[model samples]
Target: MIRLRYATMPSNGGSRTSTGTIQTPPTPMADTSTEPEVQLRMFSQPRFLAAVRALVGTMAQRLGFTEMQCGQISLAVDEALCNVITHGYERRPDGQLWINFWALEGEPTGLKIVIEDLATQVDPDDIQPRDLDDIRPGGLGVHIIREVMDEVNWERRSPKGMRLTMIKRLQPGRNSELKNE
Candidate 1:
């Protein structure tokens, strides 16, 4: 199990457009996969962002994700996790974020990532397309996620919290090679 926590620095307050004191404590998430594939876990925190990128890069390489594809996945994961850290937890620093990654064996679209966070609900309809012409530092996370992942979906759980699912399908030629073996 991968566990990590993040503490917000006073100077960096509001830099990420989050309110309240965020304390993302490390929580252990279960990894029940017998198959060798992608898997990772990190609580809502700023420092863990880099770790997420590294984990994704390693997983992508193992899954035969091309450099470009790997980069896209990394960026997408970052955005998703960031959302959890910022809006999900509202930078309250009192919650945890759980993430899971796996490669769909014997299929062309051989990879999938599920990010589960005990944060506030985010309406899928509220997500709007970003305008490239407008230069801004914020509001690009959702857009980047959608662009990078082949499939993006969200669901709300009872009581509270939300789950974001992202999927990517490899090209047909790559899928064939993976299937033959």
Candidate 2:
């Protein structure tokens, strides 16, 4: 149970047909840049991660993010999805989650990644990155996403579930840094 949709610019050459539809040349930008660009609905399954990563990475690349930044963006998203499956769904493969990708408009152009799940409600206070000194094999999703994205936050939904939001903005000269705010 997984579905993904992205707003891709028209690939048709800039032309007008008898149908009275305008088809512009494909640009590096996507229509989602001005609105909610991508939407993904998926089950709590690990098998779809690879495809998701590829799509996300390509989207980031098209958004004019650097190669390294694109990779980081995809990786952070993967980590977030894994966390939702592992923690929110408690490893239940059938639980459902919704993911949305948004392009922000401002002095610092950016992308916003949001994931919502109804599998379980988590206490925000209990969500913390494990000590890095321990060197554990897992439980590092939060740390990875936080370090990779400019802004990150986790919110508890009413009655049930959780929502996680992460954003990355291209700063002056396309450099990136975590926004402590």
Candidate 3:
């Protein structure tokens, strides 16, 4: 199990953003097949979204992702987190959400971001983006996430809540490699 502590600072409960940094090094776990991950936990509030965006963008850049790729990854992550804050936590500012960002190793390296929340359980099959042709302001987050991410999956967590996993391939020809013949 992953252990992390997030220190919450005072916020205006509006547009202000609070960031909690985890200085702990990524340690190899028993599951050797996957790479070690850096964990981040923060309050589920609108104000903290900016901090999450910055963290994911910086991590992507440091992992050799181009400016465009970093932006795409950040936007996708932002949408995911926003969904957790809005739908999962039901806009409760005091609720907590956990995120794990890591890079895959070996043959074809890529980025993976996992967001877990304990507010509500969501069925993967029930998630549906609004029709793009409808052109509405309130329902495009899911569409944007799908367009930007190479792979997007929603998993119902045991006990409660759900986990949203978003992956992006940094290589040029990753699309072809990830596609089935």
Measured over all alpha carbons after superposition, the RMSD of each candidate to the real structure, in angstroms, is: 11.8, 8.7, 10.7
Q: List candidate 1 stretches off by more than 4 Å.
A: 1-39, 175-181
Arrange candidates by lDDT, descending: 2, 3, 1
Using TM-score, give the best candidate's number: 2
Off by over 4 Å in 2: 8-35, 175-181
lDDT of 1 by residue, 1-181 (tens): 2453222235746422222343332232222443223334555677778878887876676667788988889999998888888888877755677666666666565578778777888786776667877898787888899888888988775556777778887777763233222
The superposed Cα distance between candidate 1 and the true structure at residue 43, in angstroms, equals 2.0
* Model 2 TM-score on a 0 to 1 scale: 0.78
| Total colliding residue pairs, candidate 2 | 0
Better of 1 and 2 by TM-score: 2
Model 2 global lDDT (CA atoms, 0 to 1): 0.74
Clashes of each: 2, 0, 0
- Total clashing pairs in model 3: 0
State model 1's lDDT. Answer: 0.68
lDDT of each residue in 38-124, candidate 3, tens digit only:
567777878877877887887777666778988989998888888888888889887677787767655467788887777788779
Worst 10 residues of 3 by lDDT: 23-32
